[model samples]
Target: MTDKTKPEVEPYDGGEPTELVTIDIEEGTGEAATAGATVDVHYLGVDFESGEEFDSSWSRGQSVNFPLKQLIAGWQEGIPGMKVGGRRQLIVPPALAYGPAGSGHRLSGRTLIFVIDLMGVS
Candidate 1:
């Protein structure tokens, strides 16, 4: 995907999700991602409750490369099966995100929404 525009993540008003939710905005025909793959993606993250942006790779003018295994549970579960060039949204509950309250991470205890554009998988 060559588009550099950052995706807008709307606040979720449907209440906190009890499990990881994955929604594909655009489908891709490239190689599919797997649980053990390393992926390159551009993404935006927002607090589900506050509707405030917490992070964005678009802001940095670069995509990020990450090992799926090192990411949060939500991403590990949500990203697999997605193909390169796809744009997807993931709604992550605290347990699958930073974990429950007092997990030491600032986003702990809170649900998060993320818009991810898959660039490549290897």
Candidate 2:
């Protein structure tokens, strides 16, 4: 018999059905981050489970400015404390990600990997 626990390739869920794996940040946003707070950043969203890319700003060479708190729970918890011009990666679990049903545009039940670039905060 073969050992199924040896680990094998499976469909990527974007961390949608798994536990969150948090990466330590040299700096992170404080708990004071509020909604509508403006920030500049570039990010990439990938499916950690399936090893597929979902989104990325590096390819576009653009950083975006938006409220960190206004983003999803995972993003809210992922971003912050990153100094301007800093970059970081976040592994979001499914619970903290899109949830069970997933979302539109090929984002369903997937764990998300984000490489975020901090540009400015406003």
Candidate 3:
């Protein structure tokens, strides 16, 4: 894969997403991801309500590798069918993200936006 710069996540203003929303920004010709596969990716995340950045693999100067099944529900559902080298955006509601208002996770009850670059799938 070619070296890619960090992506910026645009604020979502179309109201809170009730479900997982996936938008492909750049398409890829490599293998597509599956729910059960492990993936290597670079991503940036921001709060939908505040447009504040929450996390970024690019800031750490490394891509992350993890099993899809272990990720948040939105990712499990959204990342599948996305090809390696592709860049995609996901708008995830609280339910599919960190859970409801009292779920204890810092991002609970918050809608989130993520720009993910698929680097590898295996």
Evaluated against the true structure, the overall lDDT of model 3 is 0.92
For each candidate, the alpha-carbon lDDT, in order, equals 0.92, 0.59, 0.92
- Give the per-residue lDDT digits (tens) of candidate 3, residues 7-114: 877655577879898999999789999989999999999998888899999899899999999999999999999999899999999999999999999999999999
Considering lDDT, which of the candidate structures 1 and 2 is the better prediction for this target? 1
- The reply for model 3, stretches above 4 Å from the true place, is none
Give each model's clash number. Answer: 0, 16, 0
Runs of candidate 1 with Cα error greater than 4 angstroms are none
Order the numbered candidates by lDDT, best leading.
1, 3, 2
The order of the candidates by TM-score, greatest first, is 3, 1, 2
lDDT of 2 by residue, 11-105 (tens): 44343435555554334433323345677766667777667776665566566677776676777766655565445667776667777553662
Of 2 and 3, which scores higher on TM-score? 3
